[model samples]
Target: MNEAKIFSYGSIPRKGDRAKAYLYFKEWVGRFFEFDGARKEDDVVRVVLLASLNNGYVEGSAKLLDLCGQTVRNHLRYQDPSSFLQVNHELVDRMKRLGALSKPLTLAIDWHDEMYYGDPEAEGVAGTRRRRGSHYAYRFATASVLLDGERLTLAATPIVNEPVIDHVKKLLTQVSELGVKVKLLLFDRGYYSVDLIRYLNSLEAAVCNTAAVSHKGVEGRRG
Candidate 1:
């Protein structure tokens, strides 16, 4: 097993395990992704990740990274958002090959909403429930592996006025294609529909009608 290198004051550039992991991950993503009209794809991706993590605009993140925000914005604008499926496939494959995955994952499938400030008529925009300020938001379904102390998302797909089961099916297929076995599936109440519940019940994994962190057991589907 590889252990984390000790931080040394002797080095001019101090990169601990976290920094090393980030740099390595960035490099891996850069090698796989070839963004259109983007010569500096690394910078673009960095800004995008930073922006997403902080809930800040990508342009703002670019400015912080000392890059041309407009250029990064344009590159990001032209990229296909659905292309993440392939990347997740590669990541899961790599992890499995390297024996990094714990067997029989307890997965959680849930909805994610990115509140949109733009026009509601825009493509890929869906209605946001339980919100007065933002009626329209971009919705996504994400399947995540719930380990002892960590939650790792396996796959995500965009949802624009489609049945939750359809998106859930896509994630399940993606995860299954990666050859990761799932023992239990914890689902959010938003995805609590007749079709989805029936589908989960049919799966080899036991279905839990609760979140990953907290569970109510596999008694039956909850409305």
Candidate 2:
């Protein structure tokens, strides 16, 4: 008997396959967002998604998406803030539909400090102290859901000289508008304050936080 012959072939994904996939993705994104700009919607979505997936740099996204860097930069540079907020609101709605707000959920609020080496007088710049010590930084307060071993950011607001309690109240109000009932809030020591606790209590949400060491020491002395 003649020996049986066997053949194997390796198939690489075609560029057309990638293009088709991107088209489908763009269609889904379009269902939730509508870009109103000089750049084509497809191109805008491609650049924004690609840039997000690639460390948020236009040059890297352009190289990966086979577009000119300057073109990607222009699209981003000219993107309207209102359009971006509309898109974000749509995403948040979708997230709520995914059962993110179906029930009372534990929420975590914190401040993210981004170091800025630029001039201290720059607009939107504020002084913040981090592990690297005091520096001019842009601070943003973020509220996130702690669900099923994952944290999903729900809202973020710039914190330029705003009190932490006020920022938290604003975030809670925005989250409430999304129909989410916050069951509890977890905060860091930096956010520990009687006024903040009272505010959260007024919202009928349980609150937990790490007591600042200095506060603890003062209380100990008073005792």
Candidate 3:
């Protein structure tokens, strides 16, 4: 295992509760991520952990990790896509281990658009008419299990000109691959369509979706 060396605390109080909490979080992430090749897995995890804790950028991560900004950027730039996918799958499995998929699944499916202001040549960039932040954006369709007082994201896929129904089908297929039995599915008004309802019915999952009401006096409708 090419694990990266754990960060040294130096003069930081090792016995402090905050230090222990950080260690616990790092160890939990380490359990899910396993990098291949000569890359230091520890360093990779450290960079990600720092970025997540800070401004979610390499520069902030480098500041916390005490490494050069380019070094942090290179660590991410050189990552193999296949390895990243493996890590994602492993993380999903870890979520299951934490009882995220223990009961019959009731998923909330939705689309998230991230405003993008970068170069036009970037891949996966698309135009969005839904918001004013940026005309161009990246979209992702996510399926999350509705847990007790929280939602656990089960799967997310990039959306690039794919039909919404087809993307929902693919998301469901990925959730099924995780061995979760779908009991119900909830979606916003944007996903209200007879075809989508029929598809969920075909899978024996009850569908609850907000209908697009063109008139008043219609409420609490279920299909």
Candidate 4:
């Protein structure tokens, strides 16, 4: 049998003890394995036992097992995530791996804007009328959840107009270089234009958007 050896030393009694220790080590290796990125905490000691009967090692088995599988499972998820999921399923795994590696998610793209208030009192005191109050109107571009279910601020910019498609595409290209994939988008109707829709489709981005009625296509130009 193919076996790997590990040496452990301590003040021990006899040759028989060494044999028993090897048997225990071999049995442990044969029976179980740890996942590559999983972790267990001491918080569950009241409900679960983590100490080895032979040795006083303290660790949660299930958590270790899960971590062992995390790396492979995340890789698989990134390769082929089901489209119906609202969040970028693949992105989560990548984030987990990044966390395991002690890296942080760095923001990319020019995300302009400071607040997302529709009330007039909240508008900036002195500002450009084209965008008026905030840095820029959130609806002017395509928007997606950078990190969802968290308290989101309006300081982030969205995919605003078809005219800026090249700019947005370049930003996405930069993000992909960091090994994270952008898959889903969320935005408002004002960002809608034929070109923008086509661009989003080209990126294979499943988008959630508010619909805009184009005046050019309706009766009397459908105003």
Best by lDDT: 1
Reference-based lDDT, each prediction:
0.67, 0.61, 0.64, 0.35
lDDT of 1 by residue, 78-144 (tens): 6765565576777677667666674777778777777887888999898765464887788777788
Residues 56-172, model 4: lDDT tens digits: 222334354343333333333333222312123333444455463133332322333323435544433212224434543333222232454332121222333434566456545
Counting clashing residue pairs in each candidate, in order, gives: 0, 0, 1, 13
Question: How close is every model to the real structure, measured as TM-score?
Answer: 0.74, 0.64, 0.66, 0.28
Q: Which numbered prediction scores highest in TM-score against the true structure?
A: 1
lDDT of 2: 0.61
Residue pairs in candidate 1 whose N, alpha carbon or C atoms collide under 3 angstroms? none
Q: Which ten residues in a row have the lowest lDDT in candidate 1?
A: 1-10
Model 2, residue 207: what's the lDDT? 29
Candidate 3 runs further than 4 Å off: 1-25, 28-41, 50-70, 91-100, 130-132, 204-223
Judged by lDDT relative to the true structure, which candidate is superior, 1 or 3? 1
Ranking by TM-score: 1, 3, 2, 4
The local lDDT score (0 to 100) that residue 51 gets in candidate 3 is 71
Candidate 1 TM-score versus the reference:
0.74
Query: lDDT tens string, model 2, 1-223?
Result: 1111111111325555445544444555554444454556566678766665433566677677787777656655655666655655665676676666687777777777667766889888887654355477777787788777666677778888877777877877767666666666667667777887666556532323311112222211101
Clashing pairs in model 2, backbone N/Cα/C closer than 3 A: none
